[model samples]
Target: MDVLADINEYLNPTTARWYANRGIPYRRGYLFYGPPGTGKTSLTFALAGVFGLDIHVVSLLEPTLTEEELGMLFTNLPARCIVLLEDIDTAGLIRVEAPEETTESDDKRDFNVGDLTKAFKKAKKLDEALIRPGRVDHQVPFSHASQTQIKELFERMYTDDLPTTKIVIAPDSQSDVLTPPMTPISVEFEKNGHGGEESELEDIARRFSKKVPENMFSPAEIQGFLLKRKTEPRKALEEVGEWVRGMEQVFKTA
Candidate 1:
């Protein structure tokens, strides 16, 4: 959130004038590179959404694209927008001291995904020319989700729709059989829905968070597991341990 706040400040109307007054280019760039499924593309889109900018994604590695077309694409871009040049490290591009592209467009966010997941080799793998001092303004590394993030992810999934379990009684026996919530009852389901209990959800989320090691899984991975047990908060809390173990084994073997 601080990053977003800082970006907001930087994008203020006065900030561009400050840069221009100091004889600096009036553009900023961000590097959102990390392991797979760690929300690289997601965060880029979120940034664009927050700033109300359209994304102009260019893949330098696209087989059919040539240098001429790349220049043409940049030349035709809207004056105000988010330019996403993803994974420049993997594009086999070496830094050339060509004159930087200039535009009279208003303030915009530039994203360059570097794919720097390998521990400290980030500097070695990524060329200096691609992300020079003034080219990239910030390097935001998206690592695996922490414990708190994991817990929040779990709670967010069940924040809406009231929770209600049903019981069915057998014809001959008095014993009650429990059934998963029937949320597909069209009109009934809509009526039953309420913003779920926050306190109960927090408790369940804490329990679920405790079952797994911190920073071991990406946010996307944990969200994927939670989606499988969607609409069943109790089930998710109870089964997280087994799911974590299964995931661990898969990771070990991989």
Candidate 2:
């Protein structure tokens, strides 16, 4: 969130001018690295929605793609947009398969351009080149769901009537209410609710989280279970223990 906010501020028109004065290109880059199905792409889409900006996804592996075309694409992007570079590491530059070691020439061979971009690579130990300073300024890791994430997912699934307030983050001017903020709103579940029903729901989410071991399940797996028992919080709580055990067995067998 802090990163997003900082990005938001950096993308502000005022900040762009600030960059211009200093001869620094007005752009930002982030690398979301993790195993596949860890919500890396999902988070990118969410970010696009928040800022009401179009996402320009470019695949570097396209048969006809060239460095000139890549530069043209980046040069013509809108002031506020996300440029997603696909298959950034599929090339054998990292020498994962090839026995020959990569040299300095391979590093300069790839299309190099301005920032305000994002890239997703399915990796446990990601290549450092993908996230070296100005090229990709920030790196976000997405791993299996932890205990806290599991609890949050459980609460989000069962809570159906949550209200979302539009959050406006305008660094330049107060009247800049048009552009949306980083998140639509990160509704703090505990603080947003009141009364006994909310407490009961919180208690149920806690119980469900406890039943599922920490970081053992992907969020999608847990969400699948909750989706089947949607609007039946009590039923979900009751069946979660059995579901966790079954999942454990399935994983072990696999």
Candidate 3:
């Protein structure tokens, strides 16, 4: 299914009203998990752009991110915003066994893994409470990307260009002048396979896809390779074998 399209359809005004009529929270939470560098962040940004929503990124593992601070942040968030919690698995926020008995001073002075886990769980609970429908419209958890998805992402990144153009109209002296454009702009994709320029891009995309191995590397790894060999698609193809070997060696060692 087209995830973005489905999300856009679900975010309509009527959907919100339906949730309200049923006494349900008009919020949604989505979890996207896969390998690292699989375009979770990119997808979140795309969703925000498509829906004209703002994004707020938070790291649960931050040293200063106490429960009170988290509450304040959530309470002050504007309506219709996307909250992204990155590297949630590494955030150490999952519930765990409580620590052994310790004095107040000892607790303040030092915390073991169990103690830290307990604190994080408390903060996570607070986050959960505030991430309901009315305030936070969506909560997205990013995960690894599948091989097919990664290939498609690489194709889109190499072949497609998402550009924004703004046209401003000056105010008339006799009539009421609108300073800013109020209407949302719609972007339509026009396929021009026959066009020379488009054909060249398609060729490049095909060659690039041929060089990329399915499910062997993450999006980030591919991006790094592309950045190094920006104008040399053939070179990237030639060296990808060695690159994959090196990655495998590193993984084996790890």
Candidate 4:
């Protein structure tokens, strides 16, 4: 379950072929935005392992990113590299949010969506000298991926099937179904409070593929609740719901 090894397999020959065949100065962008600890950074390292490339990990959350530094970072990608910009929504050098629009009392600054778009556009148009076309890529617009997907990815990377473990109590060489070491529950249903759809999993899958969920509980958070509430699925679900409500309140207040 080496994350790097698993990523190598996931990369596959086709991916290498894609990397090899793309024209010089070609670039691919990935946006891996999500709540922390959902493996966003891990995925980048894994990809670097798979592609036999170097990983340039940058945190936009850092206070020191100036325009010149950003330009230099982009300009120095090795021929085959993965340049990771974490928390891109907070990229300070982009100047995407204007503070002048908000009064001190208002406590809400204007997000310069146009500036962000322009920064992205600039990144895309830059030549190899700025960033080798095929080498520099971005992972952005990150929303929390579905709980199921995150679990799968973790399982894939970790090679541990914790997600599929059965919940049972073991004693006297016999286990009781009502009590157990672990339980599996779908966060999708817990959060949405919906039952299985009459539509096929395929149909649901296709629809979701076309439009992924935003602001859903990530696998890590879901696992945290589950682990904390071990044998109480209902209580765990309630806690998750409450957490979401609290976050909503905080956001509203902000």
- Point to the candidate with the largest lDDT: 1
lDDT tens digits, residue span 25-123, model 3: 666666554446767888889889988999999987888889899999989998789898776656763433445554554323121112333333433
Per-candidate TM-score against the hidden true structure: 0.73, 0.67, 0.61, 0.40
Best by TM-score: 1
Residue by residue across 1-254, what tens digits does model 4's lDDT show?
35445445535767666756874334555555444555677677867775778888878777877879989988886756777766654443233334434454333211211223233333333233333333434424333455457434323322223444445666545546443322233443345556552233234333432232333444565456446754433354345546666655564577
Per-residue lDDT tens digits of candidate 1, residues 1-254? Answer: 36688778888989988988999977778877766688988877898899998998888788999989888997898766888887676688643333345453211211122223533233335677667778877887787777788888987887655345555677566566665554422233255464445666788889888886776677888999888878777778888888887886776555
After superposition, which runs of candidate 2 have C-alpha atoms over 4 Å from their true positions?
A: 59-71, 86-128, 162-195
Residue 110, candidate 4: alpha-carbon lDDT: 19
- Cα RMSD, each candidate: 12.8, 12.3, 12.8, 10.6
Which ten-residue region of model 4 has the weakest summed lDDT? 108-117
| Per-residue lDDT value at 124 in model 3 | 38
Considering TM-score, which of the candidate structures 3 and 4 is the better prediction for this target?
Answer: 3
Ranking of predictions according to TM-score? 1, 2, 3, 4
